[model samples]
Target: MRLALGVQYDGRPFRGWQSQREGGTVQDELERALSTFAQMPLKTVVAGRTDTGVHGLGQVVHLDTELERTEFSWVRGTNAFLPQAIAVQWARPMPEPFHARFSAFERTYFYVLHVSPVRSAMLAGQAGWVHTPLELDAMRQAAACLIGTHDFSAFRSSQCQAKTPLKHVHQIDIRQHGNFIHFRFRANAFLHHMVRNLMGCLIAVGRGRYPVEWLAEVLESRERRLAAPTFMPDGLYLAQVRYPEIFPVPAATLTSVPWSAVWSDPASSS
Candidate 1:
C-alpha cells in the first residue's frame, strides 16, 4: 500500500531534508521513526528537498508499505516515535499510482522578514531580520514583474540540477506588518535558491538600491551574477503543495488562524 503523509518541521537543527554523512536530517529522522513501527526498513520520497535551516508547513511525502494500518493509527503512531522538531500531522491512504514527488502540480513558498534593527530571540530560528526598514510598496511593485512564465536563469542557484531554466510563476505577493514583510511565491516548480534569489533582488528594490524595472532586465539577461546575494534560509518556508484533486482544499467554511498556529490547531488550519 502507498500512503501520503503531511509533515511539518523546524529545520534549524537538522542539516537538510536529504540525508548527509555527518549530521541529522529530516529524511533520516522520518525513516528511523517509521522503521521502529514497521520493524522493517522504510523509505519515503518527499515532494521536494529543502535546504538546511528552511522550514516547512505543508510538506508531503509518500511511503511504500506492505503492512496495513489505519490512517488514524498511523498518524498517532508516527508522531509518537518522531521528535518534537518534526511531526506527522496527517496521513491518508493513497492510490497505488499516486506519488508524492511526481504527482505534485505546484509548490508555494513564503519568506518572513522582520526588518527591524533589534533582533528577536523568539524568532531566532524562524525569521530573518534586516537592520534597515524595507519599502513595502516598492517590493510589491517589483514582485509583480515575476508573474508569468519566464527563463529564470538569474534566480537559479549555481548548483541547481534542473535540466531547464524555464518555469511558470503563478503569483508573487508582498505584504507587510509593522516592520515585518512577507514574501510569498507560487510556481509550477522552483529551481534551487530561486525564491531566495528573487527575494534578494526585491529587497534591493525596497532599499532604493535598484528600480522595479531592473527586474525585467535581469530576467531577460538570464545572468546569475546580475542578481543580488541570495537571502537567508531562516526566513524561507515551504508553505504548501498542490496535488491534483485528491488533496485539494475543499470548499468549506474556514477560519482565520495565524500561520504560526497551524501545528496547534490542525482542524481549523488544515
Candidate 2:
C-alpha cells in the first residue's frame, strides 16, 4: 500500500531533512522509526528538502509498504519510536500514482524575525533575530518585484540542483505583529536557499541599507552576488504544500508559532 503522511519537526535537533550516511538528519530518524514500526525496511519520499535548522510545519511524505495498518495506527506506531522533535501528524493511503514531491503544485513558506534590543532566549533557534525594527512597507515594496514568474538565479544558492532557475512566485506578504515580522512566500517551487536569499535582500531594504528600486536591478541582473547574503535558517518554516484536488492531504496546523494566527494574507500589491 502507498501512504502519505503529514509531518512536523523542530529543525534545531537534526541536520536537515535528507538522509545522510552519518545519520543525523530528520529523514534518517524518521525512516528508522518507521522501519521499526513496519517490522520491515521502508523508505520515504519527501515534498521538499529543507536545510539544517529550518523547521517543517506541513511537510508531506509518501512511503510504500506491504503491511496493512490504519491511519491512526501508523501515526501512533511510527511516533512511538520517533524522537520528540519529529512527528507524523496524520496519515492516509494514497493511489500508486501519487507522488509527494512531484505532485505538489505550490508551496508556502514563512519566515519570522524578532526585532528587539534584547535577544530572546526562548526564540533563540526558532526565529531569526534582528536588533532593528524592519520597515514593513519598504520591505513590501521591495518584495513586490519578486512576484510573478522570473529567473530567480540571483536568489538561488550555488549548490541548488533545480533544473532551471525560473520559478513563479505567486505572492509575497510581509506583516508585522508587535516586534515580530512574518514573511509569507508562496510559489510553484523554490530553489535551494532561495527564500533566505530573498529575505536577506528584503531585510537590507527594510533596514535602510538600500533603495527599494535596487531590488529590481538585482532581479534583472540574475547574479547571485548582487543580492543580499543568504539569511539565517532558524526562522524559515515550510508552512504548507499544495497539491491537486485529486489528492486529499490534511490541512496541517501551525500550533508552535503563536504569531502565526495574527498574520493576515494581504491581497497581491506592489
Candidate 3:
C-alpha cells in the first residue's frame, strides 16, 4: 500500500533532505526508521528538499510499504524509532498513483529575521539576526514587486538543478512586529535556496543597499549574480505543502481547516 506522511524536522543535525554517503540526513534517518518499523524496505519521496540547517513544520512525503498497519500507528511507531529531531506527525493510506512530489500543488515557506542592535538569545538558532535596523515599509514594497510569474533565474541559486528557471510566485509577503521580520511566500514550486535568496534581496532594499527598482531590474536581467547574496538557512521553514484535494484524515478525526488558514496571517500579507 502507499502511505502519505506529514513530517517535521530540525534540519540542523542532517546534511540535507537527500541521502548522503558520509553525513547524516533526514532521508537516511527516515528510511532506516521505516525499514525497522515495517520490517521491509521502504522507499520514500519528499515534496521538497530543504538545505542543511533549514527546518520544516509541514513537510510531506509518500512511502511504499507492503505491511498493512494502521495509519495512525505507523506514525506513532515511526516516531518511536526516529531521533528527536525528526517526527512523523501523521500517516494515511493513499491511492496507488499518489506521489508526494509530483502531486503537490503548492509549497509555502517562511523566512524569519530578528532585526536589532544585538541578537536575541531566545531566537538565536531559529532566526537570522541582523544587528542593523531595516525599513519595514521599503521591504514590503520590494516584495510586492516580485509577485506574479517570472523567470527567476536571477534569484535562484547558481547550483539549482531544475531544468527551467521559470516559476510562478503567487505571493511574497513582508511583515514586521517589534524586532521580528517575516517573509512568507507561496508558489507552485521553488528552486534550490530560492526563498533565502529572496530574503537577502529584500533585506538589501530595506537597508538601502539596493534600490526598490533593483528588484525588477534583476528579475528582468535573469542573471544569477545580479541578485543579492543568499541568506542563512536558520530562518527558513517549510511551512506547508498543498495537495490537489483534501486528504483523508485519521479515523474519527474532525475535518481539517483549509490549507490557507493553516499559515495565514493578514498582518504578514502587507
Candidate 4:
C-alpha cells in the first residue's frame, strides 16, 4: 500500500530535508523512525526540500510499504521513535498515482522578519532580524513588481540545479504587525534560494537602500550579481502545498510559527 504523511519539523536541528551521507537531516530522522515502526527500511519522497534553518509546517511526503497498520498506529508508532523536533502529523492510504512532489500543483512560503533596534534571544532561530525599521509601503510596491511569470535568474542561486529559471509567481503579499513583517509568496514552484534572494532585495528596498524600481530592473537584468545578498534562512517556512482534488491528501495546518494566524486575519495588517 502507498501512504502519505504530513510532516512538521524545526529545521534548525538538522541540515535540511534531504537525506545526507552525514545523516543529520529531517529525511534521515523520519526514515529512521519509519523504519523502526515497519521493522524494515522505508524511504519517503517529500513535496519540497528546504534549506538548513528553514522550517516546515505543512510538508507532505509519501512512501510505499507492505506493512499494514491503522492510520492512528502509523502516526503514533512512527512519532514515538522520532525526535522531539520532527513529527509525523497525519498518515493516510493514498492512491498509487499520488506522488508527493509531482502531484503538487502549487507551493506557498512565508518569510517572517522581526524589525527592531534590539533583537530578541527567544526568537533567534524562529525569525529573521532587521535592526532598521522596514518601510512596508516600499516593500509592498517592490513585491508587486515580481508578480507574474518571469525568468527569475536574479533571484536564483548559482548552486540551483533547476533546468529553467522561468517560474510563475501567482501572488506576493506583504503584511506588517507591530514590529514584525510577513512576506507571503505563492508560486507554481521555486528555484533554489529564490525566496531568500528576493527577500534580500525587498529588505534593501524597505531599508531605503534601493528604490522600488530597482526590483523590476533586477528582474529584467537576469543577473544574480545585481541582486542583494541572499537573506538568512531562519525565517523561511514552507507553509502550504496544493494538490489536485483527485488526491485525498489532507490539508496540513501551519504550525511552525506562532504568528501563522496573522496570515488569515485581516485585522493583523499594519
Candidate 3, position 139, lDDT: 81
Count backbone overlaps in model 2.
Answer: 0
Sorted by lDDT (best first), the order is: 2, 4, 1, 3
Candidate no. 4 TM-score: 0.96
Q: How close is every model to the real structure, measured as TM-score?
A: 0.91, 0.97, 0.91, 0.96
lDDT of 4: 0.91
Residues forming the 10-long window of minimal summed lDDT in candidate 3: 250-259
lDDT of 2 at 13: 91
**lDDT on C-alpha atoms for all candidate structures:** 0.82, 0.92, 0.81, 0.91
Residue pairs that clash (backbone atoms under 3 angstroms), model 3: none
Q: Considering TM-score, where higher is better, how would the candidates rank from best to worst?
A: 2, 4, 3, 1
Predicted candidate 3 versus true structure: per-residue lDDT over 44-100, tens digit per residue = 899999999998788889988778889788988899899999988888898887888
lDDT of 4 by residue, 1-270 (tens): 999999999899999999999999999999999999999999999999999999998899999999999999999999999999998889989888999998998898998899989999989888999999988899899888888899999999889989899999998888888889988899999999999999999999999999999999999999999999999999999988889998887876864457878776754221
Q: Which scores higher on TM-score, 1 or 4?
A: 4
For model 1, which pairs clash?
none
Once superposed on the true structure, which residue ranges of model 2 sit more than 4 Å away at CA?
264-270
Instruction: Indicate the residue-level lDDT of 182 in model 1.
Output: 71
Give a tens-digit lDDT track for model 1, residues 1-270. 888888888889898899777649999998888888878999999998999999878888998999898888887888889899988877888878788878887888878888877898988878888889877888888877788999999999999998899999987867676677877788999999998899889889889999888888898899999999998899898878878886532221112215443223443223
Candidate 2 lDDT by residue in tens digits, 11-84? 99999999999999999999999999999999999999999999999999999998999899999999999999
